[model samples]
Target: MSSGIPYTWDTDCIRASATCRAEGRLGKGTKHHPLEIQSTTTKKVVYLSDSGSSSLHTVGERMDWKRLTLVFCWLECASAAGISCRNEQGQAVDWYILYKQPSINDENGLVYLYMDESTGGWVPAHNPIDDQKSALAQTLLPLFQHFTNETINFGYILYNDQPPEPFKTASSSFGHSKGLVMMDQETGIWLSHSTPHFPGFDITGFWPNSGYANGQTFICGTYKYSAFRNIAVQLQYIHVYSFDAYIPEYFYPELQCVVDKGCYPKKTPWDRQLNMTSLGGHSFISYAKYSRYHDDLYSGLLDKHLESAFYAKSWGRLLDPLPSNCSVDFSVYNVETVQLPTTEPYSITKDHSKWCVTMDSKLHRWTCIADMNREVSQEHRGGGAICTDNAAVWSAFLDIVNTYQPCQS
Candidate 1:
């Protein structure tokens, strides 16, 4: 995780990429096996020559769309079944969030509260969190069912701080993040969660045994193909540690780096902010910081940009956690206790989830599900946050801040 070789994006490169997308030069697709990919291994894959190069060619030849009309037709036909976030009933949804409750004395912690645009607030899960027909299972059905098949219409990347067995632990400076990015040539979904060593390279049994203990959170959003390119650029700043990926030739050039487990920043101003719009037109802001940028991601960065005081809940069991800070323009407090409906209050130490919510929902109403903890060790790590101002999402997080540590006198 040492700093990457310096790379720069000039104005010409930006214009070339914009033109490439505008012309729909994304190439033909291919199928891949996730468990077999190695970051160090080089594959004979197609890549757009530096950003300044505009022509899209594969294997040193210009594409003939007329001869490849069949491929285009297949993509259009498959786009109808593109990947997306699903609700508890296995229906496609614009966005959704699940708060898996922790196990108590008589409970096994299988139950969770589900929320989406349709579910005004939070609704009790129809099935257990790990059940096959659950929302997560249904959402991933395409990847699980089609991965081994020869279909080349879709691609996916699974990344996490604590990946499945055999994958070595990421460098301490890498982002403390866990999530999956899946998509077709047309649309896709980005799922951000706080679970570790979960939903591994395997196709079935989406949840792992360790995921049943502590409370966790997941946010899933559906976006068009162009947005995935933006997401790939943001991951470069986050320095994501991707354990498994299947990037077809049809994917945008920005995503090719994921196949090699690369997200090292290419230039100075090692941080980036972007407004990504979902297919349904919901607005979300992504914030990313490279590992070399030393600062507290929440108090020192996000709070001021969001222009609001925050109540943050992160892994409190770690050593040397940052105390609440009020000296800055926007104060950031540490959440101490969380209480959900029908459950007793629990200490933040038992939760490994990382998220922050605006202190005043009436004014800001912002909630961010992010990577990185409010601990001294994570201050130097590369990480990012996905934030939204949707009322339902904002209320769900704000309600969880039952108690927090105020700045000392």
Candidate 2:
């Protein structure tokens, strides 16, 4: 009944024990040593060595071997609870980034590279998409648990232009964007991603293989509860897939639209632009363009601040339109090919990811990850981008621009 640091089993030892048990050799000989288990629930180290002894071990004589075994089983079940993306270690992280490579890479396109504070740059993830160890799984797993476990009280919204089927049929004039927001009383996370029909439907509780076909991107940031206010203002510009507010007492009036399953009914869809600082202190400017504004976000909204031409990718040529020419000073071009560091060049057609960067490096290092593309059909779509001036992030994205098609004068 006491609460403290949860017990963590040695993953290696656990695997070894499982293997022994499978081979029917566990506890067979004196040479087999007791499995070592550590409990951090107490202030001091409490070692429990399961050696198959008949004598009952006791903690303060009040808790016997039988009680300990039951407690251990409960702990195991609790630790195994939640969705795939829960923080397994229960450690707080500033932020994490994921880049899902296209299937063209030979491996399952679902495989992705992740970057965190511990990792200076991108590292190939060791776990698969479904594995709890994977960054995506750990980050998103909590959402599943929040819905399934009533004991977990939180608020969340899953919004995407193309939401999961059945639910997708219910919407009308939703924005062209994809993102998710989930939070408790203390802190929360806002995940901005570029995949559709993702994280699966409520009934399925699974990750869809359909999202793995083309390249995709996801940026997750942990933030204080106050940050959700700014996030709510921004979501007004995007589409809502499926939204549920468990703690209605904590809901803001603006956020209630999500709960109502309706878009704001305003003649002039309000477009907003603002600076957002993540819990990690990373600076990002959000450009939220509502559907009422019929213009390309890059050329009409961001070109002035960026002060340089851009190369963006939308859908393929069949649906793609001419690149937008800047009315002010710079132009926005269509990206034809994308080449990432240490990766082969690939056509934009193969990339469902939507992002762009300033062509000239001298202009304040700008890289943007947006939800909508430059296709003609998207001009009036509600969507936005999270842009950063960080040199490292900008350089990482800038270096991948292989070629672009300039707008005709």
Candidate 3:
């Protein structure tokens, strides 16, 4: 029911591990952001709070609920079981996690995470993924859809010693990173993808140790790829992985596929092409939503919802064909100017995925799993390398957007 300025509410939870599956009691514990603003002007997110603690107990005690609509926060994990270990001294054996790794919503319509197995001392007791109340939300009272949960296998991919041309289907077309799903499916050769989707994750968990903790990016609409952006995200480099990689966050409602109950949620990767015609843009579809994501959609740097890295078919490099040709060209379709990526200060570029808000347009900056770890995110090269000639937005744009609608009871 709350909108404008700052969204305030009463508080938080923790994950059993990196995934959203709550390890401990998903209880109604603490809170974050007495003043949380998703700045419409600067488009830059700014969070102002006096508390710098991960104690859900303490956060809930001091939260002012009249301020915001949602409360987003992060907690540190101790093991694959996602439990923070109390040492012989009855305290969590402290590890230095720097950043507050963000929990994200993604196009898949499922909230996924690969908890870094290195965060805590390996306690062989249990696996956090199945823990009823993950570290996420404390109160185990079934809160319906606070988050969609799923476990992911974040591990290594061995490039075949002998190179083959590329097989389209051989590629992991779903949660794509650029290892090489097959340069040309027709040729059966691998292109060699090196984005975040390739490398394995910690499963133990990362964050809240050495970096800044700003879990405020959890808005109502988005998709979560992997949270390991804080880890190594370089295409040129090998073994690029994440503590957790956060990809395209979607707003649950945008997904148009329906269920037996007659709800139109989106489909997963396996059946994506079979139902390719159903793939469209945001809920606000004025004209045909066209992009390289499919034969029909082509939204180039259109909005926050569309700007993403290259296709999974290629390994994080520019999706081949140099200039992708969307099925609809200017002459055939009734294409009018909706929202242009160039109108906002948002940035964009070749390699990496994130962009900064610029003067006129959203210029994308090349980023990878590494940008999440390093402080300095490099500026993208100008014209030569990066081009959106005939590109499309995210394939799961609608699905990711649908995950956030208040889940039904």
Best by TM-score: 1
TM-score for model 1? 0.79
Clash statistics: count for each candidate: 0, 4, 133
What tens-digit string does per-residue lDDT give for candidate 1 at 1-409? 0122111111112222222122232233223211111112221122223332222223436655453333223233223245788765455788888888887763758788888888777888888989866788767766675554535777888888888777877877668788888888778999988888867543356688787767888889999988888899887678788888888886887777855765578678878898989888899998888877788899877976878898988886888899999998999999999987747888876677889999785778899988788988888888888999998888878887789999988
> What does the lDDT read for residue 154 in candidate 2?
64
lDDT winner, 1 or 2: 1
lDDT of 3 by residue, 111-169 (tens): 12221113321122121222333222121111111122432221112221111222232
- lDDT winner: 1
Q: What C-alpha root-mean-square deviation, in Å, does candidate 1 show against the real structure? A: 13.6
Worst 10 residues of 3 by lDDT: 377-386
Error of 1 at 13 (Å): 49
Ten residues in a row with the worst lDDT in model 2? 22-31
Sum up the clashes in candidate 1: 0
By lDDT, the candidates rank as 1, 2, 3
Give lDDT per model, in order: 0.73, 0.62, 0.20
